[model samples]
Target: MRTLAAIVLICTATAPQAHPHIFIDTGLTAIVDDAGALQAVKVTWAYDAFYSLLITEDYGLDPDGNAVLTPDEEAQLRGFDMQWIEGFDGDLVARLDGGSLELSRPRDVTLVMREGRLVTTHVRDVAGTPAMAGHILSMKPFDPTYYTSYDVTMNVRVQGLEGCAIVRNLPDLDAGMQQLQGALTKLGRDQDAIEEGFPEVGEAFATEVEITCADR
Candidate 1:
């Protein structure tokens, strides 16, 4: 009977373990105009932290108006605080990905896009009821030495986080890799995939995602 019990346990766990963690959700499309310009791109997302992508696609000029980009505009776009939850514990993905991305939360975040500047308000942590930041950031290509990958080049500016603690990137990314929580399909980073081609995330906007700050 001991052998039988062990076998039963194996069977029960096998199915869930065998499944790949790649998640697909509600918003996952790239809408294009007659000119093949990406008008709207959305993705169904699950935030785990392993190099996972929401819905991403190629972006081009819009027919309604020229997609006015700054001279500094690079190839990729990056966002944090979403799937970045895995690097943290107890914390959860919260507001900001509002509208288009179906959520159980009843709040909304206001994004201010003017000329070439963008600011967001009403962003709050899922565990509480407060706005998320006074942070400001600017991102550009991480490197110009080479042009190979499709990785997101981001510049993270942490002004005031939940605790108002020091907003900083952990020096050891791999050591803290275990902090991520998600469906398992979302827990890994692939530099190659970032450089190659993603059906969701578009081309390599920069070399690697970069975070910048004054060590606050």
Candidate 2:
């Protein structure tokens, strides 16, 4: 994984041509209680081949380069990405009725190499059950700094809930690109953009998932 400082350097050095260094295919499974309330969410991330290779080499795994991990190697790889710094939200945001939903730290982490890519899954329990029928539940997995790009291209399901449908809203790349260019132009004018911060344009490119439930 790239450091925050490194991400800043890349963005500043590239300026108007900012691009993601890491790409991930993301999946989400929303868990619901018998009472039709959200209980937890299971997130799955499949890293791209380049980043997977970096991780494998960094951890000194797959010494044979066959992309296969032994039991001990898998054990060592588990939770390798869970060592998050403070204020990191694991690149996931859940909202109910336009307010943020608190999510517990990731648990039940699993890691494996799938088709030469590093795939991992973890479960994040909702801090409290939020009823689904009367409220809208929205989720987005993103990196605010835009150094890492997340694509919600996998299965999205709601378990233990009936009459709930998931809606996906993809970002408008044309508009998002224009917005990013404008922001970069402004940043270029400011000599302190690197020290200040890169524009948080990840959300602009994210795919939002919303859950709507029918009333009983």
- Most accurate candidate by lDDT: 2
Off by over 4 Å in 2: 1-17, 186-196
Q: What is the TM-score of each predicted model, taking all chains together?
A: 0.21, 0.87
TM-score, prediction 2? 0.87
Clashing pairs in 2: none
> Per-residue lDDT tens digits of candidate 2, residues 1-216?
223324434654657445567888899998988888889999999998889999999989999998878878888999988888888999999999889999988999999888888899999999878888867889999988776888888899888888878899988766766666667778554345447676788788788999888876
Give the residue spans of candidate 1 off by over 4 A.
1-61, 64-66, 69-106, 112-122, 125-165, 169-171, 174-216
Query: TM-score: which candidate is best?
Result: 2
What lDDT score goes with residue 102 in model 2?
97
Task: List model 1 lDDT by residue over 101-195, tens digit each.
Answer: 21223123332223322322223222222222332121222112111121221222233222222222212222212221122224234323233
Worst 10 residues of 2 by lDDT: 1-10
The positional error of residue 82 in candidate 2, measured at the CA in angstroms, is: 0.7
